[model samples]
Target: MVAPARLDLDQRGDTWSSLPDHDVDVLVVGGGVTGAGVALDAVTRGLSVLLVEQRDYASGTSSRSSKLFHGGLRYLEQLNFSLVREALRERELMLTRICPHLVRPVSFLYPLKHRFWERPYVTAGLTLYDSMGGARSVPRHKQLSRTKALRMVPGLRKDALAGALLYYDAKSDDARHTMTVARTAASYGARLLTSAKVERLLREGERVVGAEVTDVESGETATVRCRVVINCTGVWTDDVQELAGGRGQFHVRASKGVHIVVPRDRINSETGLILRTEKSVLFVIPWGMHWIVGTTDTDWDLDKAHPAASRADIDYILEHVNTVLAHPLTHDDIEGVYAGLRPLLKGESESTSQLSREHAVARPQPGLISIAGGKYTTYRVMAADAVDAARPDLASNVPESVTEHIPLVGAEGYHALSNQVETIALRQDLPAWRVEHLLGRYGSLVEELFAMWAEDPSLKDPVPGAEEYLRVELLYAATHEGALHLDDLLARRTRISIETKDRGVTCARPVAELVADALQWDSGRVDDEVKAWEARVAAERESQTEAADQEANAERLAAPDFRNRSVGRALA
Candidate 1:
């Protein structure tokens, strides 16, 4: 076996093409959760896999989630039994067997309007939800009186509901989990490349054998051969299928879900609050130092790449969430704003919100398969099914997926290490909170981060602007994770984009420098990286101000690559 390249080896070019002129067992497109999971599953089963993405990993909808790894409680309201059961199982698998470090327990209070009727109604649903996987490790729902609910979530309006239901769901940093999955896949032996767009699918008669991919970073193209090509492009499933010669069995519709991040102090909350909106659900989720309040559902017809959160969209969130807050939050309270497109299964509906989150898998042709339209909670099932669909085309003895049993890179022994955080902190001479923070993000892998700091104590300090994140993390992003661009390091690898006031603009150059040194990038490359990132921020800011989705799409598409040097002091 070829030794795995250090994840920091600038995963920017054709690592696959260098080895041999051979066909891989599977080719997975899209680097979102599903695609990443599929790569990991396929590789674990002893299948040679090659996965490609047009942009950075998690650049699309996968990164911009409400950060929850929960079974859809709202879906229970819709009486979608099968979907709920499947999601609950995946949620359990993630929390228990897979990504324990990345996925954690989060509690939400469900406000009940009509004192008696609502409580019983919600309680029955909660009972069944908890019953899935037969009483999860997390706490079951507790009935809260109106007064008790108010105390738990002080922000809720006084007269909104007679009572609320407090239930347990899972939440995660979506980008981190997605990247870790890809990294885990790499560790197991999968060749994954980001910013390498599939120009066209390579085919044998009507069946896809592989893809003709173009490296978006280096401007190089390579023909990668594979036996089965799985399209897991989320919202871009249709596009990927069409590139595979229009053979995919199902189509995906892009539903826009926008989220806003605000300071924690804005709303007093003992538990994260989940409320029902007219069109969708609104969650005041408890993120580390902030509260994630948002998710406006609307149909998106504009730019699939870089979907912008418009003023109206922001207003819609602020308006609805404000109604529930004791002290209403405004534009001033918004620390970060992001929008993601959901790949809802296309069907007969003008409203995207009503569409199903259930995933569809198909072997449209002999060697081509596509999986699309599922919530993050169900990504594992979606991926396993994709691999199952590709089984007939595979040449090797297909082993059953072991991902359900394999812990992610940082997950193994995480619990024991977390208990020993204080000892780890004292030995390392770091703050207990800081060490704990590292453990939360990296799990047992906190030792790796501490080791990086040990080699050079200077790495212990935080970045100039994004102090919430350490400088060592930037180095780790490139070295241990396959971070190829400045934006990739900051935006996906770290929460710098939402954590800071400048939205990672101020730290871009320094972070770029850190990445360049690690990747051995020359001066010309540094300049290019910096320019592209600045342009990306500028384009996003410009796009957010547009009147409608079309105009916003037009403005955002103007900056294809994220590193434009132009554009100044923008209102985030």
Candidate 2:
């Protein structure tokens, strides 16, 4: 196995200095899960690869997902059986072989409104769901009587359902998973550059050769030459394709999905809830210490970076979810709200739900391939397809993607280490639950945290305001996990930003202090970082109160991005 490359400031400097000198085999132009996956697939295939992201990794749709890695149960109704089967297979791979530490089984109860044919019909669909693609790790669906269902979820309205169907799905911390994938790719020798935007596609007489990249941090431009470039820019797929000198083979429409996070106690259910809505499905998902209830599938024509969930969106979710809850959730019950855009393949149907989730890979021009419009569950398949599209440009024999067999860095020996969590906690003089928490996030890689703890036992102390995460983990995020800013640490490395009641504001200053030295931020710079994060949180909160897209978007953009100002300040 190749040694993982350090992705800190030192390595970033070294990588940037050396980038122009080498002819990269593949250059991936996005840093979402799909782009990260493509980089991993390409690097493992014995190719020199580089991946670049404009913002922090997974800051886009990848981070804002329902956080499930599931075979979409609703897809069965559409007769998209193959898509369901393929997704199930990927879910199995994630649960068992690849990143078992990150992905785990989560059960959801589907309430049946109709008394008659619903039971048999739903049971048949679930049976196919279980058997398809040889899914074994997750248990099959179980039919429960209305009484049993009510007992399981006391918060659920007794009249809401005649019965219920319980089935297994899987979920992960999507942002963390995406970052791990990027790090795994780096481990296999892929140079990763975040905050780097591709300004233009460099072409030699229309055969695309490379990209002119702008280091968004410093405004430094570098012409990165590559044999083939793969565009995995999700919602920005069309924009990237246009930069490559061609309108893409297929268009991608953006579907906005909004989710509100409420405290776990707000709902009395032991398991998650899935409800059928008029436009699409609604999920009352079980997040740690919180329940993520969401997702309106309306078309989005506004800003892609920060998709704001308006008051109507929140009301829509609450109204639909309240239909089944004994004590209906109010605006005050919501702790956090987030919105993400889905890059759905454009269909003739006006409804976004009717649009296809299946991805397409097309070499719209020589030396360039674009992959877009896939669900998060099927990212590996999309990556493989994108890599396959680049085969024509390669003179050397490109090896097939072996990502299925490759366990992510932390996945190796994760289960065995989990069993010894109590022992480790005893030795480290920490609580067992804290050890378990670290194990779940870092897997076998928790040893790094332990080593840090060994150096300074104070590292075991929890972060101020956000006690769920230890101080040492914040340090690790900066020193090891390539967290470039306060947002990276608060938002992705740890979910303090969205998970907390204050939206990480109270902890922002403490977290900034924790990584200030590592990131070489002066006192003023640290203060600026904290203020920027606070402003961002404030903007998001204000946006949620607005009624329409225009007003909501305007509210969201009210806060200036700290990164942009910081970059300019540094350069000056």
Candidate 3:
């Protein structure tokens, strides 16, 4: 097997210089999971592919998700059996064959309030859920009495439940998983570009042929010729469609989802919890040393780029989850907070919560195709469908997508390395727990980090303020992963931004200085990056205090984007 491609500064320069020289069979316009999956599918099917993202890969809604790979249990209530079945199939594939290193099974306790009717009703639904996707990697749903449930969860209030149902689902680091998908696509010979925006579509008398691309950092422009352009821009779908000189077939509405992170000990549950709300469902997921509880689904019309979580949003989540908790949580308990937007296909329903999660692909013109509106679990299917839509436009006979059998970059030898964690720890002179942490994040790719550690011992030191991550991880983010800015490294690459109380502010300078050499950032550049990140954190903090969405959004937009700086010197 070929080694995964390095998306370092050198590769970025080369790819940029060669952009206008050749025309690819497919030009995927987005860096989120759907776009990344499309790139992987297209390249593996014997097509020349190039994927470009306006910002960093998974920098938008892709990174900030509920981080689950389950068939939507709530969708079962909506009677969307087909969607649930499809998602469950993908969930099984992710756990066993695809990216097992990143995705894992997580059990959730569904507390039953009504004694008689609720148990039987929920039982029937869960039974159908278990049977939908065959041959599951996780155990089936199990019924638990109130006593047993309280024994398992001790944090729940005594009167909160008469009984409970424990069901299994899969969870993952969404940002990391999305980035891995892009890297896997790169490994398959797809040219991936980030911080590159598509200004407009290049057309030949109504038949769209290519796009006018701009390097967001340097302000340089290039025309990328392609056989077909697949639009996977998510919430920015309409903007891309407008660039194509048409409204396209549909519209995409943005829905805001807010989540708060707190220390794991604050929620004394052995497993995660799922609660039903009036609008939708709430998930209190286990995220390493933290518990991620959230998600208030409300219509967001303000800013698509940086969706801010209002004070009201946080209160709503706390209000709902507090109903069942033995000790109610307050604002002081929250360590980190983040908000993400969902790109829903605009339907007749005014409520974003009621909108469809099912995706749609449209070929508005001869050479252009747009795909929108699916959940993260079905991204592979969405990508395959998008590629299938582009087949008619391709001059040559296109092969069918084979991404189903393909394992992501780090999945190849993950289980074997997992078994050798203690041996690896002894060999590297590190603690067993540290080795386990590294293995969980990088899987078989932990060897790459070990190789770096062998060269520079200091790289193995834990990052200050966010000791969970090592300095080597930040270095790797710059050298191997395509991290162009400080936000890219902290927010998406390592998730230190949302895992720590200070929101990565304390470790900002250290991380920037560590990656300086790899990114060719001088002292001035480093200072600028740190200041920008600090301002962003401050802005987000201020925004979270506001009661209304507009007020919060205005505050979040106060920070300056550091990546908007001109590229005066070429990266080494």
> RMSDs, each prediction?
3.0, 1.6, 2.1
- Candidate 3 Cα errors over 4 Å, as ranges: 566-572
lDDT of 2: 0.90
**Which is better, 2 or 3, measured by lDDT?**
3
lDDT of 2 by residue, 1-572 (tens): 44555579887888888888988989999999999999999998998998989988898999999999998988998899999999999999999999899999999999999999999999999999999987999998898999999989999998999999999999999999999999999998999999899999988887899999888878898999998999999999999999987778999999999999999999999999999998779999998899999889989999988888899999999999999999999999888888999999999999988888999889988999999998899999899889988999875588888999998889988999888988888888889988888888999888888888788888889999999999999999998888999989988899887788998999999989988998999988887888788888999999999999889999998777655946325323
TM-score of each: 0.95, 0.98, 0.98
For candidate 3, lDDT tens digit of each residue in 85-134? Answer: 99999999999999999999999999999989999999999999998977
Top lDDT: which candidate number? Answer: 3
- Candidate 3 TM-score, C-alpha based: 0.98
Distance from true location, Cα of 319 in model 3, Å: 0.5
> Sorted on TM-score, highest at the top, how do the candidates line up?
3, 2, 1
Stretches of model 2 off by over 4 angstroms after superposition = 566-572
User: lDDT: which is higher, 1 or 2?
Assistant: 2
Summed over model 2, clashes come to 0
CA lDDT, every prediction?
Answer: 0.82, 0.90, 0.92
Selected candidate, larger TM-score, 1 vs 2: 2
